[model samples]
Target: MSAHQPTQHVASYYAASANPGPERPSVSGRVECDVCVVGAGFTGISAALHLAEQGQSVVVLEAARVGFGASGRNGGQLVNSYSRDMDVIEAKYGEETARALGSMAFEGNRIIRDRIAQYGIACDLKEGNVFAACNAKQLEGLREHQALWQRYGHDQLELLEGEAVKREVGSSRYTGALIDHSGGHIHPLNLVLGQAAAFESLGGVIYEQSPVTQLTHGEPVVLTTPGGEVRAQRVVLAGNAYMQGVEPRLESKSMPCGTQIITTEPLDEATARALLPNDMAVEDCNYLLDYYRLTADNRLLYGGGTSYGGQDLASIEAVIRPKLLKTFPQLADIKVDYAWSGNFLLTLNRLPQFGRLNDNVYFAQGYSGHGVTCSHLAGKLIAETMRGESERFDAFAGLPHLPFPGGRLLRVPFSALGAWYYSTRDKLGI
Candidate 1:
């Protein structure tokens, strides 16, 4: 398997509509920095920007362009919290762990906003995200979700029922919804590209098309690329799903799952408005959920269906188009302008894995399907840990991450079975 992706962004709507960015040269000769970050996706870019703000000389090595991986191609919804929510954290870990996570649950969204405002990043920033419930049972789950988040000091939630829900989301498929005023969406590729620009402005360097082929750990870790080497006091592995052969240790505890997305041809303003009245990003309350939002161009971008173990679907549109039609049958004739798939790292427990390879080599991955917000938070926590403030970072790093029950070879089948079981429950609305 390759250590990273091809040296270019994948062909997706995000890539086609991405902000113009300079093509950085690959690593050449030897360079030294206070920190060397592997992978230029959200985790690496966010960490590099944070470290630069902290007065550290940072260098980011990317296998492809910035945001080329899941960071650039995800659902783009800035949903707060980890894949497993705070309540789950409290239950499985402890109150202390949950409190620490809760304290920073919403910080990622704020950090993103700050980055946009501070750097003048134009990523079509929007506000509000709705957790639409498909059934009464899921509606009750939304109520529980609202209360759970409120207990964590997130008071931006409002439960919408009946007509109230339609006012926010035009989808009649929803029985009710929970609106998180603070949650929202963006052009994910543009957002990461903008952050990369900001990092460069702060004197941080990023080398595109540079994959770390060899890592030698020491006081000054050495990361060897195809053309050159980077030596730094510490290294951060932030490639998430794309960081495959780069670090096998991190790979052992997580599996990469692929999700498909498709964007319809641009709709007229009226049509788009009717689809999503308030233009808020929406995701159904299912174990295998369907998420959709109206793009700035008025196209409906819908995504769902997972191919466990990073297997690409034969036809992304075939899998996702049906899901979209199921939600909005009125779009039966709408043309799909773009379709693609991206991988998200999933842990057995559905939480992110944050820990150190050693004292100086840290890693944050396995965000499950909640990388947009959690990846940014991971960057902040990583910078904090590197700056000798490990209290907040340790909260996540302390959690145990178990490998798949069947190991790498059989992990796919096992995960597929688990997904089938949960998806069945979702169908039964249990």
Candidate 2:
């Protein structure tokens, strides 16, 4: 498959309703800083904010506007864990390392909450989330997960039974669930924009519409954009799935997976409460999961369906509407006000990849579906590592990540084949 060009963010509910914020200027002249970060998503902006707070000169370069990528356009679920389960981490690494990583994942959620309060971000924040089980097999898995959380002394998770699940979520399709008070949702674009504003407040510069075209790694790395260049003591590659031609080596490790979402017209208070009694974000346990939550205005923001190939307005709406109706068929009569899609990097191991390409060049990506929280935490760790504290960063960097088997040319086909098998299994109830 050919490399895809960078696409603009679609006119989604988030974009239409985003808070009025100051616009940032594009990079036009040569500049130097202690660190130059690529991509103004959560990871980049968060890193910039942390580094700037340390009194380091920081510059953030974004090919598009802030929150133009997945950071601004996700399901808005701020889950308190990694993309991979703890058991998977333990199986891959040792129990000790897995426990340490798990603790850091929980810390990620705390970081987002603290930032929101500290910065006075106006994103509507809620305090409950549920992982609904679709089948008997999945219900068993939820039970096991609850037990594991208890073993880890994570008492925030409570196992909700059939009736309890229905009480929390108004869906009969889900047999049970794991309710997490630590998990929550927010206006994603607002959160990203707030980070950008905070970063600027801390004396960091953000350059929008400035894509790095080339890089020269050395004692002081050199970054070349169309109209400018930045020479910094350190470089951060936070472009994630939208890296473009920045780093070919990191690009080959993951593929861009497109996910779609749709938002309904605002429902009356009664209808909204009936749809979701507790106002908790609900996500089903499927390889291709269905996640939905109510907006502050009572609109049901439902997300599901993945496009391995590409995404357009019509294609995204077609795949997501039916999934929305399946959970709450009463919404069939309501019109879908907005539909959109975002690209997220998916790794073979379903884990975030965090490490340094070289001692001076650091990179972080591949949060899979759990990026909002992980990306924030990854940014803090990157900041810590820059200050010569690498204990937490080393835990993540120690995780093994294998590059795509077929390289750039054949990786998509290989991934598609594997995804098809999993989708088929999900369909067959196996």
Best by lDDT: 1
Model 1 weakest 10-residue run by lDDT:
1-10
Regions more than 4 Å wrong, model 2:
1-8, 309-314
Q: What stretches of model 1 exceed 4 Å from their correct place? A: 1-5
Could you tell me the TM-score of candidate 1? 0.98
What's the CA error at residue 374 for candidate 2, in Å?
0.2
Tens digit per residue, CA lDDT, model 2, 280-356 = 99888888889999998999999986666334446767788888878888777998898888889888898999999
TM-score of 2: 0.96
| TM-score for each of the candidates | 0.98, 0.96
